[model samples]
Target chain A: MQIKHAASAGTLESSDITITLKPADNGVTIALDSSVEKQFGRQIKAQIEAALKALDITAVAVEATDKGALDCTIKARTIAAAYRAADVQDYDWEEINSWIN
Target chain B: MAELRRIWLTIDHDEAAAWAALLTKSGLAVDHQVEVTFGMFEGETLLATASLYGQIIKCVAVDPAAQSENLLAPLLQAAFDQLDDNGSQHAFIYTKPSTQAFFQSLGFKPLAHSDEVVLLERGYPDLDDYLHTLQQAKRPGSAAAIVMNANPFTRGHHYLVSQAAQQYDTVYVFVLSAERALFSAADRLAMVKLGTQEFSNVVVLPTRDYMVSSATFPSYFLKDRADLAVAKQQARIDAELFVQKIAPTLGITARFVSEEPLSPVTAVYNTELAAAFVGHIQLHVLPRKAVAGAPISATTVRQALQNADQSTLEKLLLPSIYRYIKEHSSHAN
Candidate 1:
């Protein structure tokens, strides 16, 4: 899905990550800010990339501010932000389920 | 610990006094011009507060007595969310030097700072991106810059640009982009471009809220003289931003400014600007150009336009600028 507008999801609270997605002419670029950047930054970025791959999104800019979130939380926030940026209201549950399974 | 509830101070007036007291107690002056204020309340007390003024975030404070030390993160997040909803992709904040590290932890990078204040910004298309665009205009020789509002683009402005162009290899004219002046930014820019088109080394560009803008110097357009101290502080910060970020980007080694003898506020700003550029960049203070025994000024041209004195305008402005002003006199204000 092509990103249509700028949208954001999640919160700044502990154990949650805030993900902001905006349309970009360049390919996917992630600006990740986390306290654990020296250790877990790569893993956090990998999870976001996996989520975007599942959604078939190739060109978008992401700003993720991580507050010690789990992998599942990162995936959920990325998916929500991608959907909002794409302006797609209906969730493709079966396709999402296939990615999860 | 009682759960903190998010409240809007602009919509709810009852908590306004407490918010003011909190800001004052935190050693911050209360500015009433902020557009939106978000407060985190616990029962009857205010715990944390942050405000959004246009794209700028100001007057952020967290109660010292509050249980959680992490109130700043949430407060800033709410402000950013409001800024995003308002369709602003970038955010700027002016805060004390002591709090720089705290803000940097949350992805805010420092743009420029003095002993008293530090300017920080978050989001894309930041200062580096701005400097990259300026890099395209970079010439090989020693360069000088002139920043002007040029409200009506008078002959004095022409003299300043002409003088700088003759002295330096290249002259970059940064026109103030704020719309609070009598003439619109576009009109002012067009006038400057036309006035300086005679010089091959002169390039006119908008300041783009980076120099002499409401974000950098809030009191520049405000007529109130009571805030002279605030105006001086803002002048220092604005000069530092120029010296640290802008001048080096375009290899500007000298700056030209017209002597401001009539306005005390501008005199103070000139003092602060000179002090900030000490030992870093050369400052040239040129005498104001005169016409028919009187100094040429945009204010004088504006007064003449108001009274429909075409003779005074003919003497003070270029022929082309005078014609442009004559055509747009209806919307001059």
Candidate 2:
């Protein structure tokens, strides 16, 4: 699915990631910043990409400011931003929650 | 006054022990479970220290000579900036009663009180500002008030609002701002605005760290029966602030709440609300709206969505809330 417009989710608080996204025509482009970027940058990006892929979302610009959010938090925020961008109402709750499972 | 620069405390820092001793000497209990502990130092000497543990900022103390100087505010400002840098927009400071006014002068409003510590916040809108904004849109006379999360605005919530709009001259719907909620705060605000559009007299406001807010009642998130006693006391302090400050500021004469059969936490909160406002404001306890012989609540609406129970969700939520949640709920996997 194509991102329809600009949207955001999450916060700057500890253990949270604030995700901002805008529509794109080709593929997902991610720009990320985090204190532990040197060590976890690739890991965080992988987590985000996995979430967007699970949502079947493509063609988007993603900006994520991570404050040590765990893998599950990154996924949730990424998918949440996707929902806001697509302007869809129903979400895959179990899939989003299954991070723990 | 001596110049004080911030010093982040660490085990290697030379003054770490001094900071610990100061809190004890100052009659303030030391919370070892701090997220960040720092102090204001004058050159090599530590004059004051404050600790942050989640929303609670504590372990604050000043050297005897520095007490007469104006230093607490700057020390607090340092802590506040740290909290903000970490993405906390609103925060609580645990301080001694004698120094309460010092915090108040710096835009920190007191929310709850105990014999030992007082809780104050820096980001909640001032009561006067809230009133001023409401004045431009509505009149002040015999208003009914309610504070709700409406995580997903249920039909039961709508029923309560409809009754309040008809029974009173004005209705103030205060949505509990989320430090964390399933629905985004922006979406929740928009849903309520559109949901209650028919009632021109209905004024929606953010429950700005006022009563039963997450900041005022952090223990509430625990949802454990073991924490019940402490939660009750916290709610009492919060409700007192509501009846004593917030209700009077808005000229609200009656407060509305539904009896909770589903959550023990809310049932205790309602009981506290009733007790706090007995002589000040009338408390109306409305019965929970039920569907399939069960109460219609945000909790049930969330469960239905998680379970993919479309019929239960449709029955529990207003069309707007259902639509909002359908589009906005954060998935769990």
Candidate 3:
């Protein structure tokens, strides 16, 4: 299955990425457009992996268009988009703890 | 000289009316505004009058025609004595600028000059603005947080901020901005600024009414409420908003708080908020720095003022605040 997702920050030209998923695979494959790949090539791949792990869905192909995103924000957005694609309304994303253990 | 007579009077409507009547007879016209007291004295004779306006006692006067020695002084002293005996926290008197010197000699300072009246306050100023600004600033290194009420920039408050500063690169102190507070917002801000002058990185900002007022929840939640769950949820929502929306705007991702039991509700809310924002923000609760019994609190300072225990208050407050209070109070008393 092929999924297309677009994320934008108004008037700055929206970035779009496409991901392809295969059956029975427990890892993700990410494809990036040339422009985004040039800017955030390695970081985007890492973010895709983290987002997939966060959603507990390992078998997937992912693509992304990069605006400016920190690793954490990218992870958050990816998990949100993937959840939207799967029609999953609930995910137990771990809460952030402020205290030092 | 008028004879000095000690009369014990309850602060009630009838007593206020009787006091007003006596002041009127003694050539002192009292409009009888709430929270005002008036009196008249001649030679050693002391004529006392008081008007009760709601929970506050106003329009205390002494008979001018009555022969009394130091009539005004004794009359004012007597009224304060009565209120002190009754354990009143709020008291005020309106006198002309010329007579201000006399009141100052007695221990009252001009509260703040206004177009209509020169107000005199008996307590410390509130430092909410500075604390709010601090809370709004971004925390450095995502390591620690800071909070403060800033009731009057005391030495103890300075000590707390300094300690927090040492631990965290950025400390955000939340100044309470509830309208009903005793000190004016500006005065409180000024005092806190003055008190924390040495600490450069500390950011102080005002805590909006929703976060700090009794309408939402008490500062510490000292008493157990029936709807603890509801209160806790509301507090959590407010804290989340503060952390996610407000804190981020100021570049602060962490909150530093003093570990005191006075604000259990806030402590609980912070714990939950921290969990929700885990990995994004940090919450640090510092143990109290105490000299005598337990940690220092504004309540303890106020109690000392009420009891005339200047020593304890001096110990708890900064030198500037102590000097301001002493100089102003000495003039008024």
Docking class of predicted structure 1: acceptable
Fnat per candidate, as a fraction, reads 0.33, 0.00, 0.00
Instruction: Give lDDT tens digits, candidate 1, residues B192-216.
Output: 9988889999988889868987778
RMSD per candidate (Å) reads 3.3, 16.4, 27.9
Q: After superposition, how far is residue B84 of candidate 2 from its true place, in Å?
A: 5.3
Deviation of model 3 at B261, angstroms: 2.8
Order of models, best DockQ first: 1, 2, 3
What lDDT tens digits, residue by residue, belong to model 2 across residues B118-177? 777654234444555655655667898988887778888898999889899999998877
Provide per-model DockQ scores: 0.40, 0.02, 0.00
Give the chain B TM-score achieved by candidate 3: 0.51
lDDT of each: 0.85, 0.74, 0.52
For candidate 2 chain B, the 10 contiguous residues with the lowest summed lDDT are: B122-131
Please estimate how well model 1 matches the true structure, expressed as its whole-model Cα lDDT.
0.85
lDDT at B279 for candidate 2? 86
1 or 2, greater by lDDT? 1
User: Which should have the higher TM-score, number 1 or number 3?
Assistant: 1
Off by over 4 Å in 1: A1-11, A20-30, A51-63, A76-101, B1-14, B329-333
Candidate order by TM-score, decreasing, is 1, 2, 3
Write the number of the candidate with greater TM-score, choosing between 1 and 2: 1
lDDT of 1 by residue, A1-101 (tens): 98987777887777888888878777899989897889999999999999998898999888888889999899999999999888899999898988864
TM-score of every model versus the real structure: 0.87, 0.61, 0.41
